[model samples]
Target: MGKLRWNILGIRGNPLATRPGMVKIQEKNVMLRKCWKTLLIGILFTLTLLIAGCWDRKEIENRGYVLGVGIDHVVSSGPKGLYDLDKTPQAAGQRKYKLTIEMPKFNKQEASKEVNKGQNHLIWSGEGESMFAITRMISTKTYFSPFFEDIQILVFSEAVAREGVGDILDFFLRDAEMRRLTRVFVTPGRAEDILKAKLQVEEVNSTFIGKLTANTDKAPYFAGKAELGQIAQALRSNHSFIVPIIVTEDKEVRLLKGAIFNKDHKMVGEMNELEILGGKILRQTLKQGIVVAPNPADPQHTVAFEIYEKKMNIDTSVQDDQILFTVKVILIGNLGENMVHEQDAVDPVFTKAVEKEIAAEVTRSIKAAFSKQQQLKADVTELGDLVHRQHPDYWKNVQDRWDEEVFPMAQLNVDVKIQIRRPVITH
Candidate 1:
């Protein structure tokens, strides 16, 4: 082929060129690039195997799920006893946190007669300057790791709540395992008492409280469900809110009127049962309640009205730089008990008089709630919320001082109307 062309420094034709079985310099470069890519991929795969996430993962069998938690302020140095739920250490002057974590024990399936029969749960507690520290210290005494995902309810003693719960809430809010739906409560006595109190119907104390709260229809007016989400939002926003109060009477837990929180995130005052009912009326959350009063036709006989529905209209205004609010409540109820059945339930005259008497009771409650609102200087009625939603510009100026300055001096007006839809007999 044209005498086989040969280049300089070559003994034969195409000395620098690639042969069928041999690699050229250009081929070596390509091979090196491919080898580098393969090496990088292998190294990445090896690293992925070494780096495992969630190092703290624990098996379900080894986990002790916390059902309910209670926090109380130590008043005095209680008896130093091991695994005592009610006892806690207290400082002389400074405040300390007493935390109780409740965990239900799993009954073992065994034929042995030595198995323990009573006390289905294990309660562990620790005292510390902060909840975060206390939680870590709890493991020092307990065998199992405390898991918080299953937590249902959180109870705070009045002393702890009065000192302010912002410090206590900080840890719970930051922890990803914390449940936002946990119902919150404030107790008059030690909060641990509510957690340790024996249950009559339900075996689990947490379940008992959860069911009791879920069925607020038992005492709807006085009992309010304040989830952790709402409480946290109120805390972050620096607004006034209310939490249901729990009382322990001889191992029995009973929910009572709401406890109010001011801008400082501390309990400034409390609402009585009547005022709590009235506050619910103002908020239009009164689902099922009984309004007892003297018979309108006969002053001696008694009458009871069961509320079925409520509608409230809150009219707010800023006149002369003074906050003015008018709450109009309309309740639709049924006449539950009538000592004087001689008066017809369908009679317009008799129903009108009954409506008047019911309206008077509602008015009295509204007045009573307003009196407490003035005394506390906090608007748990959500009056500020209305001003912010409808009147943004006005709220921007008064929001900071609404609880301390503006709300206490605001003018309030309450008007109530009741309509008895159908009368029922309870035998």
Candidate 2:
């Protein structure tokens, strides 16, 4: 290759007009300035490349892609819910959350299949006052680094939830590497048990739980999915919210009912699938809830309607210093299971009777949920938020005691409307 040469031929700054020596000096000065400019440009280019280092890049093999995280309340080795730190940090009753993470290794998973033929994922836990601390401590127990960029789910034990998840949520929210869409759950016994449960369908318990939650279309009302960011928003707004419940039994994990959080961001109680119905109706997210009503023609048999469409209207008003809440739920579904031996599914009269029965069933269920909410002193139905939106003045007046006093004493009127169709019939 031929060397390329740059030619900067200046005419010696008009040597004929000025003194030759002076002109020569000027040309020299000009040449020096050009050389310095070129050197500075090269140095700046090299510096730019040096500064453009990849700070966020990480090798895939180096990352321990966390699939799920479980948080549990660890009783310090001391008292029931109390622990003296002076004794030992590992006391029985100190307020501590044991955080667990599930990470799957594909290569090791295949190897394990050939070896013991068991699980493909690893579950590790550590104890700390905050999730952030426990997450870091988890590194001590694992050879690979604990990474959160791919975390799919976060499970909270009933005990941990009762203590409030606001602090845990803060760490997740503040973490730049965490996914905002990470699903959250509350377990009845312990989150670690749920995380360690052996899943028959899936090798990893977290995978099974994640897949279960992903089936929202089957039961959108009860099998609801709440992301980490969503819970944080509710926490920031100081609103009571609900998280799905997961239970472990006989080496199996299943997502069941839901856990209720109060305005203080602590789990106050749990909701049956039916109580979840009321919340769904109130929130207008009641897409699928099976209503089993008494057989219209035969009292012995029952009829089940699979809710396909639901619409709810909440009318709140303050009358005579009393908060009155009216929840009108209109449901449209078809006869999914008709065990009413005396009643025919195709019969219009029987169907009409079934509709009324199912409507009443839903109404009663919702009313039960309302009673439960009153019992728990939680407004998970967002009734208080609704009242606050319409009547800010009223909300302001009762905001302090809305849950304990006003909500419990409030009059809730439920109106249910049902429409049913035969299985073969469309629309």
Candidate 3:
């Protein structure tokens, strides 16, 4: 006070000097600020941890992966009719569908290797009019959630197919969980029997059956795979389509026939092995198959020509409201096997003879398919679609009566040519 040196504040002595009490106060302020910053950072970290997780995440084991579904009609209300449904609130005549779902038996140890017989899958059955209710009913029977996202196939009995698949297919088409690529089939026997059948190839029957559709490239007898998505599209477009028929005998499952449907959305008829082969040829979907022909040298033995390449050309014309389809089939293949040991497949003359016979066989198959489809008045070969695509204006006129009236009377001319490229190394 005696010196009266002015500080920056103009209230104290030395401006450069700091007081001990003031130093303590500044240190306390710094420490308090650091504490506040640390507290704020800690709160932010805690909040991040609280919100950083999937609230509705479901583990794989908790999901019931429905691999296949079999739909059958309840023919009666007897013991075999659907199930003892006295417990559920099912309306009269509403219990129309028998829903069967197949799930893979998930055993981590056995999953790596193939399990013989039906040990690979589990089956559950329920009957109800509403597919939603039937599926919901399945939930009460299992601990895991029924997930249809992984479903591989849907099988309908022949009876159900005849009754009409539209009702059963409606749920699958509208469901968000169902995949479009799921294979569809019609079986003459019980649909449930197909799922229950024993297997030798893979762990799951549904997966194996789904894989079987891929064999269309190898087997011409197949009517090509009828996927659910394709069926849905056909239904919406009012287009007649084919559903491959699956048959089981002695626990052996086979896909050798195809069920044809008219524009009426019901099964009209079926195509046999030969007819299906021809249909594939007409559709230009014949990829690879063995076309066996009677050898000229030895009528008792047959010459097998393996089709590796094929091209089909169709010319459509409408005259006086009559549709005439002319199909030119060109087949390129190798001599797969020659049962006639005397005849050399390498000889040009022999090769030509074989080619001629193969062409005749192909012609016969095509004609058979065309005639059968015409007789049944079913346009399952997409002939109507062809008209719609090639001559839209003409199709608009005949679109309504195309399948029933026009297609049945339509004339088909088939021309087949075969070329044998090579022969198997063996005799």
Q: What TM-score fits each model?
A: 0.78, 0.79, 0.84
Please provide, for model 1 over 254-348, each residue's C-alpha lDDT reduced to its tens digit, 9 standing for 90 to 100.
Answer: 88878898878899889988787778766667778788778977889988888888888888888999978888988898998888878777778
Off by over 4 Å in 1: 1-59, 78-95, 108-118, 297-301, 341-346, 424-427
Q: In candidate 2, how many clashes are counted? A: 9
Error of 1 at 36 (Å): 27
lDDT (Cα, 0-100) at 258 in candidate 3: 93
Per-residue lDDT for 209 in model 2?
77
Q: What digit string (tens of lDDT, one per residue) describes model 3 on residues 47-114? A: 99898887788887778999999999865755645554565777545778889999987775675454
Q: Give candidate 2 misplaced runs (Cα > 4 Å).
A: 1-56, 75-95, 108-117, 220-223, 423-427
Question: What's the lDDT for all of these models?
Answer: 0.80, 0.78, 0.85
- After superposition on all CA atoms, what RMSD does each candidate show versus the true structure? 7.2, 6.3, 6.5
Clashes of each: 0, 9, 0
lDDT of 2 by residue, 260-345 (tens): 89988899988887777766777767667577778877878888888877778999889988988888888888888777554556
Prediction 2 global C-alpha lDDT: 0.78
Best by lDDT: 3
